[model samples]
Target: MDNVISVILGGGRGTRLYPLTKERSKPAVPLAGKYRIIDIPISNCLNSYLNKIYVLTQFNSASLHRHITRAYKFDNFSKGFIEILAANQTIESMDWYQGTADAVRQNLRFFNQPNIDLVLILSGDQLYRMNYQEIIKEHIRTGAEVTVSAIPAERTQAEHLGILKVDEQGRIIDFSEKPKDEKIIDAFSVSPSVFDRHGIKAGDRTLLASMGIYIFNLDVLNTILKETRKSDFGKEIIPDIIKKRRVCAYFFDGYWEDIGTIKSFYEANLKLGSPSPSFDLYDEKAPIYTNPLFLPGSLINSCKISHSIISDGCFINDAEIQNCVIGIRSIIGKNTRIQNSIIMGADYYESASHIRANRFKKIPNIGIGDNSCIEGAIIDKNVHIGENVTIKNANNIEQLDAENYMIRDHIVIVPKGSVIPSNTAI
Candidate 1:
């Protein structure tokens, strides 16, 4: 609705995804090689015919902000755009947003429309695709003050999520934020017939965990924020209002992944190449959009590729690749092999004599000698491996330089734009 506004919570330290997020915010982390994480929600909004978006974040948001500006350029003359609402300490009582509620509270000034009916709040780092219109329909039908989109989770996983107890009418009767052991012991496994595939269980004690998506009537949202007087929906806001307010649950079931961890992120990327992935970005219904690179079609140069989502303008020559995502304009040397890894993560390309994996630990020295062999690693942009360099786990250091790179949990991270010395070991 033109009278509605969307707020995306993008603020988080994202310390868990250290090296990847070192120079960028979580939302800014590149997804699908070309699109950033924030594009998922923005694309959802655009496809669902929702406009007016505000992204909230604090740490290293420069890249995220730049991408948002460059990617989201709808018809400004009408009423479609994506905006980043960063943390600002304009008020004497102001500080950085401490929690979710606090983040939205800090940007209340953006909600200036008297006609605005609902505020759609979402998380920026999740990997999924959905139509928000359906959730909005449920929200209006229930006449709820706050409607949360929830999905079924494993009982053990539910312990770490903000769970909901919804009545037959789909109205949330109880809400608990990341409940403890005994509190969720009696959790029910809702019957398949209890609710449709949205993973909604309209059963007794069948706790549904919130997916961090909320739809609130603007007035009710303003009122709740006023009443709570504290930041964060889980810690202060929602938990405090459920007793005195009508907060409902909207169940959603399709596919979603919060790729906030390096392992999860890597796993999610590999899943994209699976025979049947949990999340599919190529869906025509809700296609994900990002800043257009306008690159040409990707070309595989007689290379053997088992399973990889190679984007535009890629060249492969007698190389072996499996379970990897190759971005645009990336080149693989003849006879080089890549397996179970992400490569050329950024959109860059330049003709190099030889480049291969397993050099992530070593300096990214190009000019690899003819007989060099490499494997099992991540390669940063524009690295040159000298000719005849061998990189493998069997080598004596099993780890490499700290000045240009560092190994975290066995994942080699090459700092951006560092050249590896030839025959580097130890």
Candidate 2:
């Protein structure tokens, strides 16, 4: 892996995951109580022994930059470094990153170094544990110029992903970028024997969808980017090169979920608190890495908690939490009942003086106050919910944009640094 370099694309304007992406970038969104979304890919690279990494960021990247700087610090002897390549305005290109391909093209000078043989492209906002060495070795063995990591996806799931048709040798022959037409999607389906050959169970998932992961030969990538003005890899670059270059599919039958939208993000987090989660966070061998906050264990005072993940430095007093992910430094007051929700906790604890001042000013303290009921919602970081607050969507409205919260796909999302006063209802 010495000759390999990894580039993680921090997505542009995460509109689907808005409110969460309102202040921070998509990659900086908190996940499973403790870790950030970007931590998943960076930890995968470090575990795979691919140390040299560059994260491409464009929109609302301050928090993401801070987390990366604090979490990853390598010694001088290891020759491993994780660098951030933020979008810049230069003489060559003055506009922002038009798409993923454009983002890479703008930063090609860094990746086009002599020591780097292959450039591994990854999405920053995905949840998965992958040994990237396996894909790189397969790329070398097959002599493929480009290799895309693919996963078996069902028909309903295929409409939102880049679907590919592969030959017997696993070479991608035909490609479609998020085709909504059922006829086109059905034509791209793979045979059951293909799944059997790979030892993956072929249930209803017959189509091989791209996981938005790619490996490209240094020379081929430079040549392709120089020849075309294609702005995206999935929608333009990958589909265009499939007919001309040696593009192959690397099948991955692992637990991978793209946290792109509110509905997907909500479900993915709740699943982590399940009895048996598909994405494991307890694997010691390939452990996920994050910032080390030297905080004390949670102080639970007669709280009834079931099937939940409560992070460090939390203080819950007589609260009933079930099927939820409570983040770091969270404070749940007495008689609060939280179910099927995510409470992203505060960054800094409010001192007694600060709390007194907040009370003087008629503002709720920086955590969940007493006598609150929250369900089917995502409470972002540093949110203040006062006593007698009810956050459940009683009307079952699918979409809404209010002053304090926004509802998308029937899940109410309280934006970061928001405040809901006493006796409030949603």
Candidate 3:
């Protein structure tokens, strides 16, 4: 692991995520209540002792830069280093990242060092916990030029992922990028006995899909990036390399999700509050790390909270919060009901004097005001919801841009730093 380096690819524009990516990179988006999406892969790398990490981001990278710098810091004596490689224009190459392969090719200078043996390519906007040691060991044992992490997918799910076919020896034979034809999918289906041998129950899925996680031999990566002009790995480089290189698949039977769309992102965040979440953030063996905001515990006065996660430095009074995730420094007034939603909370706590002043001036401070019924909404940071506001989508609208908020997929989203007036109905 010491000789191996990890590169987490921050995705492009992230149009599918929309307003969530309006002001920040996809990786920098907050997760569960306090952690960022980038924390998942970085934490996995740290727990695996792969300390040399480089995060590649392009759009709206200011917040991503801040989070990476503040969250990861190793002692000067250790060789561990976590760095960010942003897109820049130089004399030789004056272009931003066109795709995933292009992003890594742009930062190939870092891999020129002599100590590097392999490169672990990871996606920043994914939720999963895995140990890379097993995959690395399999790569070395099989002498594969590249190893890709693979997982079985159901029929509908297989249409959205890179599907692959492997021989009995676990060597990749062919690949297709999201094949729609049922004949092609069934032709590449692996046997249930193959999954049984690996201690995985085949369940209903038979097709194996690439998890967008790959391990490349240092020399192999350098040669491919130099000779091939492939823009993407899954759609281009991988398909070409499998024919010429010794590519193998490493099966990972765990909870892994690509939080790419607004609906998926919203659902993934809410899943954290479930009684038994598939992905555990509290795993002591592989804990997720984030910027430690040392705030006081939440002070709840006669509030009824059920099946929700409340972060630190919150002041809740007589609120009924159910099936929601409240972020740090959240302030909720009395009789407010928040259900089936995610509140990102405030960046900084407002002083009592300032809140009093706002109240006197008939302005609401950050967070939900009294008697507001918010159902199925995502309230971003620094939002001031006025009193008696009914935020529930009354008409079941799919997409609409209101005065200070946006609705998508029948879910209302109050963007950051928005202010809703008192008694507003939606």
Best by lDDT: 2
Q: Rate the local accuracy (lDDT) of all candidates.
A: 0.72, 0.95, 0.90
Candidate 3 colliding pairs, count: 0
Q: Per-residue lDDT for 14-88 in model 2, tens only?
A: 998998999999999999999999999999999999999999999999999999999999997997899999999
lDDT score for candidate 3 against the true structure: 0.90
Report the C-alpha displacement of residue 366, candidate 2, in angstroms. 0.7
Ranking by TM-score: 2, 3, 1
lDDT, candidate 1, 37-108, per-residue tens? 888888889888998888898999998888888887877477777777888888544688888898887778
What are the per-model numbers of colliding residue pairs?
Answer: 15, 0, 0
Error of 2 at 426 (Å): 1.3
Model 2 clashing-pair count: 0
Model 3 poorest 10 in a row by lDDT: 191-200
Residue 216 displacement (Å), model 2: 0.2
Highest TM-score against the true fold, candidate: 2
Write the residue-wise lDDT of candidate 3 on 368-417 in tens digits. Answer: 88998999998888888889998898888999987799998888999888
